[model samples]
Target chain A: MNINRNNYEAYFISYIENELNNTQRKAVEDFVAMNPDLKNELELFGATKLEADEKIIFADKESLLQKNSTKIIAWKWNINVWASAAILLLLLGVGWWMMNQSAVKSHQFSEEKINVKSDSVKSSELRIRNSELIKTEKHYLAKNNFAKTKRVENKNFNAKIILPETIDTAELPNSWTSRKKWNEEHEIHVVQEIKPEEILQVQKNVAEIDTIKAVAQNAISVPPTKKTEEKMIAQIPFKTSKNERQILKMLAWASSKVLGKETNNGNFDVSIGFAEISHKQALQDN
Target chain B: MTINDYNFCVTAYADHLFRFIFKHTQHEENARDVVQNAFEILWKKRDEVEMEKAKSFLFSVAYKNKIDQFRKQSKVNLVDEFSAQTKIINEHKSGLKDALEKALNTLPDIQKSCVLLRDYEGYDYKEIGEILNLNESQVKVYIFRARQSLKNYLVSIETVL
Candidate 1:
């Protein structure tokens, strides 16, 4: 555009604003020179252009700097999580089954370590007075006293007096002959009040029971202490079912046969009134 | 924009933003607040802003914040201007620099922001227009009127001297 009396001021602003080229700037200078009366106003206009203030800076740019390295993560859901859970559960189940299998194998290799601590008396007896058990087993399985042992196959049979080889419970009959079957038969809950030592002693002497009817019959001839026996019978615990009573009595008599000293003395009161069933009587008689 | 781009805006434009806001607010804390507010808004909307527009966005926000601040405290502004002039008259023996500064303060806020953004940032008229939400011609007019006002202020001071 042309600089004129009317438009010269716009030219002047552009000139001072450094918006003008050299030709336009020179034209503005020439026009201003031609107008000396407007010179002071032009100088004031030039002076209005403010200088940059270098000193006023933002003091703490540090506060604006974010230190968190948080990534902008768009939420992505895993639809396969159920599959992963199922796989994890499968692994856990397999681990549990393996552990259970190993536990059974270890069970078969194990047996109770029988302790044979004797009571004050040399001949220790463990008998149950549960007459009900006696009647049932005596009628049915009692004839097998000679076979009083489906468990004769157990290594514990030939075991010596002290610290015998453990009898493998697996070899025992499926009947309540094994202690495990004893436990499994939930029908009975006989808490043995006898020192477990007395039971262990009976267990020890049980090995001496000769599977001969001749020796067993001789034991029956050893005169019975009917008076002492009656007193001991009063001490018996609850009357058991026939099978459990028969088992307890058989164990007691096997122990008695080996402790011949106490029996010969006739001092064997067997006062604790436990049992000696037809199984052992049959074994001793055999 | 990325975080690095945002931080670059901070390093590059913080001083200019501060100086521009400071000229209008005339108080360091108030200017810093305006400047900080601008940067905070920029950071919050970082994803929406472009790197090329960061400086313009910051100055635009700062200018609006300063105007808002002024509007909020407008009741006291006249009293402040009167006191400023009184202080200027009392300190009349100071140089043209002080006179020019006082005179700059005397101009309306729009002229002050326009002229200062022009000088301090060396922004072209379109750039200033973009920051102030004015057209290029409006920016030019505001700058011209601001210069005329400043020149008149200088003339008054010269006659007094």
Candidate 2:
């Protein structure tokens, strides 16, 4: 209660910091409560102390705050970006599933078909004709029971027959309907021409006709025309079983369908005949 | 806390927090920066920050930011120089503003900060300790030292005049 400026420094410092024990604090509080002059001195000291603790404001503060603010903003931006990425992934998954469903539906609706070209059908037809020719030659020789005669031709002989350059394209009645029909049924491949032995035997038959003419049995008789000879040769039987004939017709129909065209055209004549390859063997073996 | 709560905290505490930072760093711009950053951090963590602890939390952030700034500068002499200029101003008072300003600057950075929180912001020693990352005893010592320093400067003025 009777405190003076001389001792105030030590006591004031301890008092403000609450360093005083309970009794000391109580004494100071009671003294201030009773004495206005003492209280006023304390208040002045407190005000002056506050004034003395002033701070100077410097210019660098703004830049520091700006740097700190920038850091805080960057952290916020990262959070937003992560959220956006998660949303994007979810959308992509949905879109992918939708596309897969449509693709599967389209695949189910489609059909697979193979188209055979027209050229292949034509080639198969040619093959059938050749096989028929070989079969006819075999049958003819077997039916006659002819001796397997070999006519040895003299290559040096001047009597070699010359074939005609061209044949007339005459429309013949379809005498070979069954042959044509048989050919239409099968997938055909052309066989090679008859052997030299067959050609020699034909030449021998011609020589015999010449000899008979020289003996004067028929003075007016003429050499057979190439067309007539070809017709006679084609008359040889190419016997096919009923089942074989049916299969050949089906193959021909299939081939025609592949070409997208009809096989039997009245304008087109098939006159090429079958030639035996081994007449001597056929005649002897039969 | 919502946006409104965040704004309220900022409006209530920004200037006081800036003053504390300014007292320590002696730079108004750096003080503003430290306070703003502290508020921004609070805003970002609004949900986690409690209203009762908001003041201390903000001061704690600002205090740490100031320390980091000083450390980055990498020269103890700079801090000492700042302290010396502050001491000189406190001793020589040309005007009331000059005297008060210098008096505030005279305290060491930690003491200055403690005094600001105590007198200007009206925070207790426990709150000061939490903000400055000091123990309660350390906070008490800082505030005590700061007040003593200010009293001596004011007494010197009275004696000289």
Best by lDDT: 1
List ranges where model 1 is wrong by over 4 Å: A1-7, A71-286, B72-93
Task: Give the interface-residue alpha carbon RMSD of model 2.
Answer: 7.3
lDDT for model 2, please: 0.45
TM-score of 1: 0.48
Question: Please, what are the lDDT tens digits per residue for candidate 1 over residues B70-120?
Answer: 645533434234232122222343666777888888888888889998888
TM-score to native of every candidate shown: 0.48, 0.42
DockQ values of all predictions: 0.25, 0.08
User: Which one wins on TM-score?
Assistant: 1
Error of 1 at A227 (Å): 59
**Relative to the true structure, how large is the alpha-carbon lDDT of every model?**
0.55, 0.45
Give the distance in Å from residue A28's predicted Cα in candidate 1 to where it truly belongs. Answer: 0.8
DockQ of 1: 0.25
Task: Write the residue-wise lDDT of candidate 2 on B29-146 in tens digits.
Answer: 4555677678778877878999888888988887786556753442222333444323223345465445656676566678877777777777778888888889998988777677
- What tens-digit string does per-residue lDDT give for candidate 1 at A50-91? 886666577788878765454322222233566678888999
Question: How does residue A276 of candidate 1 score in lDDT?
Answer: 29
